[model samples]
Target: MARGPYEAAIPAKIADVDPQIDSRTQSLVEAATVEMVRFDAELGRDSAPFAALLLRSESASSSEIENLTAGARKVLLAQLGDRSSVNASLIASNVSAMQAAIGLSEDLSVENIGTMHHALLVSTDQGIAGEYRDRQVWIRGNSPHSAEFVPPHHGRVMDAMKDLVAFMRRDDIPALTQAALAHAQFETIHPFADGNGRTGRAIVSALLRAKNVTERVTIPVSSGLLTNTRLYFEALGAYREGNVAPIVELFAESAILAVDHGRLLAADIESALRDYRERLGATQESVRKILELLPREPAITAEMAADSTGVSTATAYRAVQRLEEVGILSPAGKIRGVRVWVAADIIAALDDFAARAGRRSRH
Candidate 1:
C-alpha cells in the first residue's frame, strides 16, 4: 500500500478519530474555545470591518507560508482596485478564498471545497481552478522521487477527499481537534494542483466559524502558524506519524494567540478611529461617511469612495481632501493617474500584527 517516499496515506481514516484526548489537551481546547467565543461576542453584529481586517491578515500569513509575500500596503491598495504586485494578486485571491470558505461554512462538502478552490485560482490560473489534480503532486521538491512528501496518487484523491468531508461534518470531536485533523487530512490528500496549503488553512477558518467557536471573527490562525512555521510543519509531519496531539496542541495554542493578537488589533483600530474623528472635530457628512468606510478598507480611491457613498466625483474628492488635511489619510502615490489614499495608522497596525506573529519564526 505504501508509495513513493511516503507511506500509504490515501483513504484518510477520519471517521474513526481518537475519542480520548488527554485531560491537559482537553483543558487547552476548552480554554482556547472560550477565548474564541469571547473574541466573537465582543465583535458582535458590527464585526464586518474587523472581520475583513483579520481575514486579510490571515490571507497574507497563509500565502507567506507558501513563500508568497505581500505587505499590508500592497494588499490594501489591491483591495481598492489598484494595480499591485504579482504577490499582492495571489494574496488577494487568498482573501477571496477565505470569504468563500466562510460562505460555505454551513455546508462542508467536497463540491463546496472545489468551489472555494475555484474562487482562489479563478482570478489567476483558469486551467486548474476547481478540479482536483489529475496527476500526481509532491511537496518541497521538483519530483516525487526527491520530494519531502509525496501525496496519494491522483486516482485516490477524490476518495480521500470524500472521507475528509465526512469527517469535517462530524461533531463528535472538539472543534479545534476536528479542525486540526481535517486540515492535516486535506493536506495529506493534496487535492488541488497548486493551492492545497492555502485551501487547507481556509478549511481551518471555516471549521471554526461553522462550529460557532467564532461567529463573526475569523481567528487569525495563520498568524499563529506564521509565528512558528517550523512547528506548524512539524505538527503536520507528526500527524502523518500517527501522533495527532502535536497538531491539536498547535491549533489550540494558535487559537489562544490569535485571540490575544486580535484583541490588541481591535483596540488599536478603535483608538485610531477615535483619534481621527477627534482631530476632524465634527466633519462634514461626506467626510464622516468616508471615515466610517475606512475601517473596512484602509486604502481608497475617490471613485471607490464615491461609489460606496453615492456621491459625485467632485464631492468625493473634496471629502478626501478634507480628511487628508486632517492627517487622517495620506496619499500613497498614484496608480495609473488616479490618486490612492491610505489610512496610515491602520496599515501600520496590520504590519505590526504580521511582524509580531512572524517574529518568533525568524529567531
Candidate 2:
C-alpha cells in the first residue's frame, strides 16, 4: 500500500533561530563539529583497510549486539583492524536485520521487522533478544529519579507507522523533509521492546538514502545523538505530541553537520593519496601494478601477487606485507595457510559510501 504525508499530533512550525545562541551550548556544538570534522578527515583518508575490517566486523557484531558487552565490543573492534577473509556470511548476517527492517530485500514476503528481534538478539546475545512483551508496557526512560509517563496506545502508533512508510516512499515531499518526518514517526512508534534506538538510527540512514539527501556518506548521526541523550529524547517526546518542528530541525541540523564532517574527511583522504603517490616516485611502478591487480582480484595471495606483479613469490609477499604494515592491506584471518591479503578498510568504506549514495538516490 502507498503511504502519504505524516501528520503531527499537533500542528507545529519551525522555530526561528535565536541570534542569542552566542551562548555556551552553541559554542560547544561548534567546537564538537570542528573536532568531528578533523577526526573524520583523518580517519577517512586512511580508513580503507580499517573501515573494511570494522564494517565487516560491524556486520558480524550487529548480529550479536544483544549479547556483546562493552568489553566484547572493544575486543571485537580491536581484533578487526588487521584481519581479512573475515567470513562474508557473518558480515551479511549482521546487516540482514537492518536490510529486512528497511524492506531492502527482493523477498518482501519473508517477514516483518518484528521477526528481526531474534536475529538482533542472537547477534547480541542479550536475553531480551527475540522476545516481545506479552502485555502492554509503559515506555519509560532508565534515568535515575524520573517518574515515567505511560501514554495510551489506541492503535494510533501502528497507523502512524504505515502512514510513515508511505510518506517515505512518496515522490511529493522534499527529500529532506520526508527523511526527517520518517525518522520522527518511527521513533514515535517505539514498536520494539528493546533496540528501538539503534533501529531508529538505522532507519534514519535508510530514509536518507531513500530520499537522496546524502550521497556517499554514512552520516553516523547516532554518534551525534549520543552526545545529548536527554535532548534527543526530549525532542523525540515533543514529536509525539504532534510537534514536528523540533525533530525536523534537529535532523536537518544533524544532516548538515554530518555532511560538513564528510567533506572535510574526503579532502583529507585526497591529500593523503597525493602525498603517498609522491613518495613512491619511480617505484611507483609497483603501485601501478598493484592497482591493476586490485580490481580484478582485490584479495591477494602470495602466489597471486607474484603472478600479478611478475615478481618472485618472496618479493611479492614482501611488497604486500609492506602495504599491510603501512595500513593499506591486512590478512583476512589467522588460519595462515593460503592466507589472503585484502584492502579491506578502503573497500569497505567505498562500499559504505556507495550504499549511502544508493539510499540517498532512492529519494
Candidate 3:
C-alpha cells in the first residue's frame, strides 16, 4: 500500500523538552501538587472507598471522551456482577485498565503501557490488546486524506514509544510537567490501533502515582478534562503544533479541579457512612464489615457480601436485610433470582461527581 504524504509529517522522535517553566506556571503546578498531596494524606492508608470512587470517575469520564456513556447506577451494578449492557462493560474495562495502570506505575515502560491498553480492550477487542498498530491509523475522519491527524507509521511506533519512555525517566522536570508531556506525547504517537485516548489518560493517573504527586488515590483529572472536551482536544492539537504550554497548563488546572472535587466526594462518603452507623445503632460484625466494604463496593449481592466480608451466606443475607431496613442498602433488582442491593446514597454521590466533573467549564 502506498503511504500518504502526511506520513512524512508524523513525529517519529520525542522532541527535547525544556523542563523549565516561568514562575507563574511553576506556581500553578506547585499549587496543584500541594492539593493532590493534601487530598492523599487526608485519605490515609485505608483509602479504598475514595480510591474506588476516583478510579470509577476517571474511567467513566475517559470513556466518555470516546463517546462511550454509562450511568453511575449501571456501572456500579455492573461492577457488582449484575447483568451489564455493552456500554457498562466498556466502562468496566476502563476501570480494569485504570487499576492496571496504577499497579504498573512503579515501572513505567512501553511494555506496561501495552499492558494497560490490553487490559482496557481485552474484553471488547482482544486482537488489539497489548499490541502496537501494525497498519496506518487516522483520527476524526473516514480516511487519512481527510483525517484531523495521522499518527506516525507503525514502523516508527516503537522508536517513538522508546523515546517517550526515555523522556518519562528524566528527574529534572516537575512531576506534573513530565506527566503532561508524557500524555501528550503518547497521544501523538498513537501507538495502538485503538484505545489511545483512554490509554493515554490512564498514563496520567499512573504518572501521578509514579512521581509521588499522589500517594493513595488516583485523582480524577479526566473528570476535569471532561469539563471541556473541545478544549482538551485543542490542547492536544496545540501540543502537536510544538506549543506544549497549553497541555501543561491544562493538566495543572485539571489536577487542581480533580483534587477539589475529590475532597468533596470523600467528605460526602464519610457523612453517609456515619449516618448509616447511627441508624444501624452499633451494628454487628457482619454489618460493620459491610459498611466498610460499601465505599469500595457500593452495590453487591448476598454472595458478593459473603465473599468480601468473609461471612457465611446466611450471615451476609441477614446483614443485607438489616442494611435494607436502615435505608442504607436498597434493592436494585435481581439477577437470576439472586437479589442485589445498592447503597443508593453512594451511587447518587458518584453520579453527581461524574456529572459535576463533566460539566462544561466556564473558564
On TM-score, the leading prediction is: 3
On residues 1-363, what C-alpha lDDT tens digit does candidate 2 reach at each position? 324432223212222211122244344444544543444355554455333332332333332323321222222322333233233333343444554444442221113444554454455445656454333334544421232533324345444445555555666654445555666665555555566555555566555545544332345454334334455567778766766566655555555545543444345434444554554455545555664454334466767778868888877777777666566666765334566666554444334432332222111
- Rank order by TM-score, top first? 3, 1, 2
Model 1 lDDT at residue 24: 93
Error of 3 at 348 (Å): 0.1
Taking the tens digit of each residue's C-alpha lDDT, what string does model 1 give over 84-177? 5888888888999999999999999999999999989998899999999998888876567667888889999888888888888888888998
What TM-score would each prediction reach against the true structure? 0.94, 0.54, 0.95
Summing lDDT over every window of 10 consecutive residues in candidate 1, give the lowest-scoring window: 1-10
| Clashing pairs counted in every model | 0, 28, 0
Where does candidate 3 stray beyond 4 Å?
1-8
lDDT accuracy of residue 188 in candidate 3: 89
Q: Name the runs in model 2 displaced over 4 angstroms.
A: 1-122, 126-160, 223-227, 282-319, 324-363
lDDT tens digits, residues 135-226, model 3? 98888777787789888888989989989998887778889988988999999889999999999999999988999988889999888788
The lDDT for every candidate, in the order shown, is: 0.87, 0.47, 0.87
